[model samples]
Target: DLNQHIDNEKCTKIRKQIRLKRTKIKKYKKQINDYSQRKHKYEVQKSILKDRNSYSKTDHDATFMRMKEDHMKNGQLKPGYNLQIATNSQFVLFYNVYQNPTDTRTMIPFLNTIQETYGHLPEYIVADAGYGSEANYMAIIDNFNRTPLITYGMFIKDKTKKYKSDIFNTQNW
Candidate 1:
């Protein structure tokens, strides 16, 4: 296994760092709750201003002040980097991390990195529905020079009704 051949001491250190990150996320949650309490009070003040369409007043002043304070305090939240991996039949050789929140933007960047490292494009690519989009599909054709067989999860909005089929959705396409 990979663990048996890796440096045990370095693995131990990485595990310790992960524990610290978990604690940091817990603290961020607590701070967000405190801000929510203050924002509730501001909502009461805002209600008074709505009754009178007249010019500015102390209630309006208080609302703006409270909103600004809450925005500043709640700015920090639990966040993490995204991990991207590229694997082949033989092995998983490439992985990268970024702050991107969705797989849509990641497809091209990941392919580019793999090409740079391996000196050739992969013949096939497979990913979940989250990574399936028009842009991502085009990237596979234009950038990777390969046709990706993408799989998307089929979901029906109305469970009671059968999905209507059209020419575009048929297997013939």
Candidate 2:
């Protein structure tokens, strides 16, 4: 009777060991699945970063830019290209697509394109305040041999200020 009792105790211990092994297997399988998912996500991100101007999954060449039209009132980024054009008398003389989102950086490349196509630069470049920068101003003067009539970012604000005293007015002359 004592031998039979010992045999039963050993059988119960073996069953508990098997149950613990099964639970461990399930936990390991779940961890492996999670690791695979994380690895796949990293691979996709790496592929997107391989392209310089890519901001969208559908269009790899498009860049994220802030548009003037914001219906939501929040500045949302949209994937698009900068379209630069040189016009004369309301007619489009030359047009170029730039990958850059800012007008400040697009000036030199657009001027270079115009020179490459027409073999000469325009006499004057009249652009908005968005294209105004020290580098852009020098590029127009040095490379294109033209003057940029571009307004600085604070041109309008500076003109509207009424000084309390004429001592601050440099334009009084």
Candidate 3:
């Protein structure tokens, strides 16, 4: 929904430019393929020639590259950008978006960041399987004295039978 804040006209223009760039890159890809079966000298010359067609080639590549670079710079849309929302006793917003990816390796660092930002730790932490490594669990207990509410590996998905049998006993948590 970040695009919600962007100007409509600007977004349209950017999309149009991206589509045009993609078409150009596609054309270059075919040209490169045609050159591939030729001698190395021919391939090099074709690549050099392709580079000159800025709008048709380099511009297209640059557009995608810039989009990725901008996301990385902002730390809001990286592959590892994890969104963490915290709630207090009444379930009201406490603190959120201590930006990071769900990596057990980063758990302590991010927990530290949250503490620095909010001046304290939540009584417990909850995260999906991505953040369920031993390192993160230990850090939560040792550093924060908190039990991380992680999904137990024993749970199985079964929606059909209500008031279920022994297969769906205590392991369903």
Candidate 4:
């Protein structure tokens, strides 16, 4: 009877140890799950903060622009400022740095910068098709009183005969 009593005590002790081990395992699993959830939440928050127009952390004023780097053949977008330069006779007449990546909106601002510095606008302005917006043309004519010798965006396409379906061909002439 004493041996049986001792056996029952040992069985109860083993069961208690098993229950304790299971409780510890459950606690550890809950902690791991909580950590995983917190990590995921932080990752989501980080992604949410990153927007299309997000600036560089190193240079806050510099915006993301596609640059022609030697290492990157695909032209990766990096943080940099757009430089606008006006030249005459192979000499740089005026230069400015703009935050905007596109040249279409930078023409007027660059011209205005030149005017502000020189106190007079040029008689004529010449630029590529990229600076051929109507607003820029109007600004050159009305605000600066200068002739804009800029081409339209589709100037090359319009010049090609293959693109012109309705225009009469001069091959017969």
| Tens-place lDDT digits, model 2, residues 8-57 | 55577775766666678789999999999999998886787564545767
List per-prediction Cα lDDT, in the order shown: 0.63, 0.83, 0.57, 0.80
* lDDT for residue 43 in candidate 4, whole number 0-100: 76
Sequence-dependent TM-score of model 3: 0.36
The candidate scoring highest on lDDT is 2
In model 3, which regions exceed 4 Å deviation?
A: 1-80, 88-103, 152-173
Query: Per the 3 Å backbone cut-off, how many clashing residue pairs does candidate 3 have?
Result: 2
- Write one digit per residue (lDDT tens) for candidate 1, span 1-173: 33333334367767566656656777898889989988987686567556432223432322221122355686543233457977667587789974454667777888888888879875778877768788888889986789887764453322323344344445424
TM-score per candidate = 0.45, 0.67, 0.36, 0.62
TM-score (C-alpha, index-matched) for candidate 2:
0.67
The better-scoring model by TM-score among 1 and 3 is 1
lDDT (Cα, tens digit) per residue for candidate 4, span 130-167: 89999999999998888999998988977776766645
Best TM-score among the predictions, by candidate number = 2
lDDT of 1: 0.63
Clashing residue pairs found in predicted model 4: none
The residue-level lDDT of candidate 4 at 78 comes to 90
TM-score of model 4 vs. true structure? 0.62
What lDDT score goes with residue 154 in model 4?
81
> What would the per-residue lDDT of candidate 3 be over residues 59-129, giving only the tens digit for each residue?
32221111235744764432223345455566755444422323454557767877887788767687666
